[model samples]
Target: MREAPPNAVAAHYATCTALAFSAVAVPFLPEAVLLYAGIQYLRGFLYGSRQWRAPARVPLTLGRRGYRDATTRKRGEATWPVGTADGRQVWLLRQDLAQGCAFQGDDPDWQAASIERLVFAACLNRMGAVVVQDHAAPPLAGRIAAVARPFGCDLGMAAIDLHASLTPPLHLTTSAIEAALGDLGLSEKAQELNRALSPVLRMIGTRHGLNALALYRAFLDAEALSTLSRGEYEIDGLTVNTDGPASADAAALVDLQALGEAEREEARQELAPYARELACTTGLSLTDGLDLGTAIAARRLTCIRPASPLTAVLVQALCCEALAAQEPVSGSEVLVHLGELHALSADTVRRFLTSTTAAGAIGTVALPSTPDATLMRLVSESCRIRFEHRSTGKQWHTHLISTLKDCTFSRDIEPFLVERSGKTGNI
Candidate 1:
């Protein structure tokens, strides 16, 4: 033949040997990564857990989409070979998941994650299950439900997992899955699915012979079956609402690899300032807001509002846009996710929101109307200056509030003083 291509025999032999040894490897996920950044990851994990800001709290909106977009994946059933146990087909869950993931700037392989999720969904289809996830991806209410939706309907869920987030991870249990399944409102089939799958999961655990499965079996037995079998849950749900197909649009996809390094560098240079400003506004970082705000700011507005101490509405919008990014969230799921990032109480959040809404400060923030009202009253009561707003219904209040943040935490919230050359400027 045509001079049997160079290195063909050697390549073939090497490929054969590699494929033959595929089953031979690490004892655990840790073993796989140890040769790499195992020590670094461990160090980060130990130190990082302390940095979690908010205590674990329930999500409002049940992980619902705060806003809508205009895209649709429109995937058909042929691609999703794994239909519901009763054989109900779904739309392009893969594309939809990607779009939703785009909404969050996150992406996991739909085939694999969805397969795993569908297996669990298949197992828990009869009842709403509460699964303690031991998977690589976090078992957030929205994530699980996102994968679950294309699989079936009337599935409500809640999840409780161990602190083993410290470990690379362990395995999940049938009971844990069942718990999430039943914990939320699920269909009758959901319960039946879990009941059937629990034993099967045990058998699979026995087969894999991994500790995760063994522990999963133990967890299933640890507590009596919860009253998760109630059928009312599908109607009375807690969280995990999708932003739907409308939000599935709003993106223009391109290949980063397709651009030259020079072009990429130039683009980064141009976008850096916009990125920094957005990070400040959203309380996300440059990296996090890259997929969310910069694009919008560049295309729509030069600036955005609620720049700091981000309000609930802003958080909701950021979440919507962030989800569009399809990446993991930094500050979206914890205590801060519910809108309270500071020590401020609920009343304070409401008051600030009310004031901003009334003042038309939603798009552009100037200053507080009541910042120096006492001074205004004093000036009006005592002097004849008739000190009023300048041109734009804004005056010194603009300067103070605009400067308050820069003053407040810029240097540990410096104090402000009315008189004298220097006082510990209060804020």
Candidate 2:
């Protein structure tokens, strides 16, 4: 057996310790770290009000490529083999619930993190579900899952199951989930945590392709609209129609079409906020402009998906590329900004930037009369990349759209911002 490296071992210990203590103290979505198909397990516990236990170590099996693997008893706490009502079994792995951390150079620890994600994908394969519950957002989760696809698994969507397997399993409607969330004793505590992190989420929205501020404003707007319209209103799904005619290959309509009525309703309650807000503020209906923008954003993200370690660098760089004609800022400035956002070490950020710059994924310009002053810019607004099969010499070209011309947020997040700004004096 190959012994784990010292750094990997240390990181494992630190992560497990943090998760164990935190799960015990704060029982908010303790199973949220699960990659896919674990949402039902979470719903079961949360709705059933059962006493939840943080499994010490999940049983794992590493077998030959085609052999049936048997579970090996590992170190730490005993693993739990919790069977879902659908007859699928998932072991509560180690106490660590986090998927992966930010890049820390080309170290054994980073490899270990990648290994964990691979294991997660494998587990999802066995459990047989493609939806993931990612607080980070669907696009990012989709990207990471795409990276792990080579491990014989593919993640489909980012969502949570609204029902748990019980006797005559309860399928929750949108209002039901909302009500349950409102009354959960953990909501206040979770809110406190989210409150602390909201600013950070907003600051990196542009660079990360998430647009947190816009999403939040949309959510708030949906809530108000839902209330005012007495739950009769709906945000129709539309294709993105920007920068000339929308491509048929543009992402399919952003709809909950794949889900059952209850599932779709619940998901709509969660995601439609962002989409509807996008529509209202832009004066674009779901069928006209908003969907097109979503398609564009989704299309841009395709290029970001296949690149790892380079993911953040590419995401930030693409945003910069779209927002300006010339190098809006020096490569060093962008590097520093990314470093602060991701909390990466100077060395790791520098190396990532250096490698990508050399590969021409990122472009730089020299300032006049300034020695060694090269400002970073995007390579192009859009371009095509070719990937060739090594053995067959078969080649395919993929068109990559590096920028979204309509990546705009709500004006001051509109009505929500106005109230929060205290410009109204008092209620």
195-282: candidate 2 lDDT, tens digit per residue: 3223432432433465443444443343532321222212234322322353321222212122244443344455443333332332
Q: How many backbone clashes are present in model 2?
A: 5
Q: In candidate 2, what residue range of length 10 has the lowest lDDT sum?
A: 409-418
Model 2 stretches astray by more than 4 angstroms: 1-125, 128-138, 155-427
Query: How well does each candidate superpose onto the true structure, as a TM-score?
Result: 0.15, 0.19
- RMSD in order of candidates: 34.0, 28.2
Candidate 1 ranges beyond 4 A from true positions: 1-167, 208-427
The per-candidate count of clashes, in order, stands at 49, 5
Clashing pairs in 2: 239-291, 239-292, 240-291, 240-292, 241-292
- Per-residue lDDT, model 2, residue 389, is 13
Deviation from native of the Cα of residue 291 in model 2, angstroms: 18
